[model samples]
Target: MSERQVARATLVVGLLALTVLVVVLVPRDVVPGGPVTPAPVATVLSADEVERAETFSRWARTWSWSSLALSIVVACWFGLTARGRRLVERVPGPWWVQVPLAVAALVLLGRLVTLPCAVALQRLRLDSGLSRQAWTGFATDQLTTQGVAIVSTSVAVLVVVGSARRWPRAWPAVSGSLLAALVVLGSFAYPLLVEPALNDFEPLPDGPLRTQVLRLADEEGVHVDDVLVADASRRTTTLNAYVSGLGSTRRVVVYDNLLDSASRAETLSVVAHELAHARHRDVLTGTLLGAAGALAATGLLGLVLAAARRRGAPGPGEPGIVPLGLALVAVGSFLVLPLDNAVSRQLETRADVDAVRATGDPAPFVSLQRRLAVRSLADPTPPALSQLWFASHPGVLVRVAIADRVRAVPG
Candidate 1:
């Protein structure tokens, strides 16, 4: 079969898999009864609070958008121009060594370009009382994040180049399947490998809160072996919790700040929400979707690179393709942001519904949402475009409305 035919087959299979998974796994009617009407911002937040959140959000969006645009520009400049190819060709090594080095160079360049925006955003968080991390700790975190990105990208590039070199015409099918499997493997490994690098985690102590959390998990039919507390207060003041990993590795992780500041009920509200995610295997669903996406992206990349080669660009196995491949990935990720976030919002909403039903009380849930928004200085009503593109969870008002709707349902 021709390379184009193979690529087309891979793309179609990936799309079909992704579509079927979304339809089968994603929840449609999570909230009970009619459409929910969000509570007015004024009802929950004071005038001063609303103003502060809005001002912070505006600056936050500016910096975040600037960083994204700058990164894309840097990637495109290095990927689409002769300069990037020349840089890669000048590097002293074989394809294996040169490809990894080229990927590192491109990633580092993009990170450096966007450093100013990152600093500005961090400063904003600090000033708003959202972040308590010192500059040294912040710098360390940045380096750690960049290191992970470089390592992951280098591995992926090596696989692509190696596959293309070994199986030219069939590289797309081979690489796509390999990467998709890697995506699933990475999801399972993340809790074990990546979580430890960022924070110190300790098992939640034997206490009433722990017992209540375990009881909640039991009631929800989630098999939670232990609850872990992260030393998040070392870096930030936000209250949050999440369930991470697949199967045996899965555990509930809560912020220490939350344990210290929030009441028992409020803490359970948060944990219950996370337990809902676990009960529904939302993380697994997300991982499967991501794997499908990687497969589809690989096929599309193969097609585009084949076309580019005919127009004098580098072939798939060449070191010169590294920058172009990275650029395409950056653009594709940005383009898909809205769809990803939309799915995330739906899952989050379903979790909220389950949490409310599990607890059979909406007062603490409502209060918890308000407290989180106020403490984080989250805009109660973010701009529609921002919510569409970037917001993973629903807006504060929307979450509160979900609780209210649940409460209003006849018993």
Candidate 2:
């Protein structure tokens, strides 16, 4: 088969595989008792609280969307134009050295363009009492994040460029498979390698809360190693908890703010939600689906770059392709965001269900949701499209309604 034909076939097959995995693995009807009808925001939150949430969300969303749009525009400018190619060509180095330098330059340039929006958002968070992090901390966090991005993207670009140079015709399939494997490896290693860079974690300590957490995990049939508390209070006042890693690295981490601010019952309610994720292996499911998505995106990228090459653009192995590759990835990730979030919402909702069921107490679950929304100043009634596109978890009102339904159902 022609190389073009092979690229097309790969794209089609990768997309089909991604679709099948989503259909089979994503939970549909995991919430028991009955369908949940979300209660009105006014029913739970005061008018003042709702107004504050709406205002915060409005400004936060504006800044967030502005940053995203600006980044895309900058990426396209650097990726598709003659000026961009000239910029990369001006760098004096071999392809190996030039690729990483070019990637860093383009990535940092994009960040520079969006830095104002980031600062604005951070200011908003500070004013709203959501973030406790100071300017120096924020700067440090941004650098750390960009450093990780540059390193990971450089490695990916090197592999792709290397593959193209080695096998002109089969690079798409080879690189796609390799990248897919890397996604799994990244998922497994993220908790160990990345989490430590941002915060310090200590065991939840021996106490009633620890005992209950362990006992609860036992009841849920998820293994209990230790619950770790993150030094999240240094960064933010918002309460949070999550289960991360896979297999041996698996851990349940709670924000220290949560332990200090919430009641034990409420804390257990959150732990139960995370335990549900562990019990169902949601992380593994997400990792596998992400690997498939990455492979599909690679195939799509191959086809697009091939088309560009026919139109006289640089070949895949050229340094000029670096910006274009990054731009394509940014655009592809944006386009697929809603679908990704849709699956995330389903999984999160399923976890919520398990949280209430395992705890067998809807009161704490309901209160916990309310407290989280209040603490985070979350808009209980967000715009429908925004929620559909970006919200990873079910809104607080819907979660409260789910708890109510579970409580109403006869045993």
Candidate 3:
């Protein structure tokens, strides 16, 4: 097959493979439950929790549909415009030229997609969690950080494309090599540079619960030195928590939204889920996987852009390149997000199991999960496909089932 055809086929296959891998990794069963704890403590939700949940639901509906519409429009435009035809018709260039352009286009496109969503997200009166700084930080954090890689790769793409008309056959090799080099360099730097920053939030205390959580981690042979509670409610009403940082900085963080809304049992359950990540080392695994996915997408798209440039098609302009990068990254990230979350859910499942295992009580975990489901208005039993693609935590029904199943036969 011709080089362009080959590049297109390769892109298709790689994306499909990644998507399949992500789908395959979705956790199907609960992990082994750990020690259980007693007491089904309940806590009342403040007005803030209710407000945030309501806001989140609205924002979710808006952004989800807004972007979905934008995607359809963009796709239709690409289709009607016969944009791909020019790339297809161009004589295949050297591997280097073709590859670099494609990668640059991909990276540029990936970065661009964030802008609209960021804008759409900002339009809402959502809380400021970490996302509060997303727009302003985009220049430094995402654009410049990952943006530089994208721009560098794009420049290489332009050179390849520029060389193609004069030296079509020579274009591919140069483009490919450049693309490869860019990907390799980016793989290492992106993580170190973009490691998630600790957003403004209240610090955790030297309280009993704090001590107990760490003590429990120690019992499981896990070293967890930091625990933080983020004022996530400032960003959005989304009820969420995550364990961020690496090695010594690794911390289990709770969303203030969760803290205020969840009962003590529910709050502990959230923390337990994060603890599972630390205990099972899922955080490290996720960080590595996320970085790898970014690299792979960057490389693949770079190749396509290189080809387009060689053919004299206007290399996707900054406007176009940015969106393309966003599309490709979103596709790649979405494909893997489920598996990433599934890995997380496995640890979470284990933590839930651990909660039971530690305290011989499953009720608290069950209650916590259920309350979250109701309060968050989460679709507890979404279609398997939807859940695989979107859920970051196990569904409430699944979590509750695990709790019930464990109670029937405790470890």
Top TM-score: which candidate number? 1
Model 2 C-alpha lDDT per residue in residues 1-411, reported as the tens digit of each score? 655776777788788989898888898876666568898878889999999999999999999999999999998888878767888998888999999999889989999999999999999999999998999999999999999899889988988888888878888887888888888999889989999998999998898889999999999899955699999999899999999998888999999999999999999999999999999899989998988887788788888999999998899878889988988888888988999999999999989888998889989898888989998999998999999889999999999988877777623
Instruction: Give the Cα error of residue 98 in candidate 3, in Å.
Output: 20
Q: Write the per-residue lDDT of candidate 3 for residues 27-88, one digit (tens) a residue.
A: 34454354333222223234455455455655665676566556545533342344533333
Error of 2 at 281 (Å): 0.6
Off by over 4 Å in 3: 1-59, 71-198, 236-239, 260-264, 306-311, 314-327, 330-351, 383-385
User: Ranking by TM-score, best first?
Assistant: 1, 2, 3
Where does model 1 exceed 4 Å of error? none
The C-alpha local distance difference test score for the whole of candidate 1 amounts to: 0.91
Return the TM-score for each candidate structure. Answer: 0.99, 0.98, 0.59
Q: Which ten residues in a row have the lowest lDDT in candidate 3?
A: 35-44
lDDT of 1 by residue, 101-125 (tens): 9988888889999999999999999
**Candidate 1 residue pairs in clash (backbone atoms < 3 Å):** none
Candidate 1 weakest ten by summed lDDT: 402-411
Candidate 3: residue 282 Cα off by (Å) = 0.9
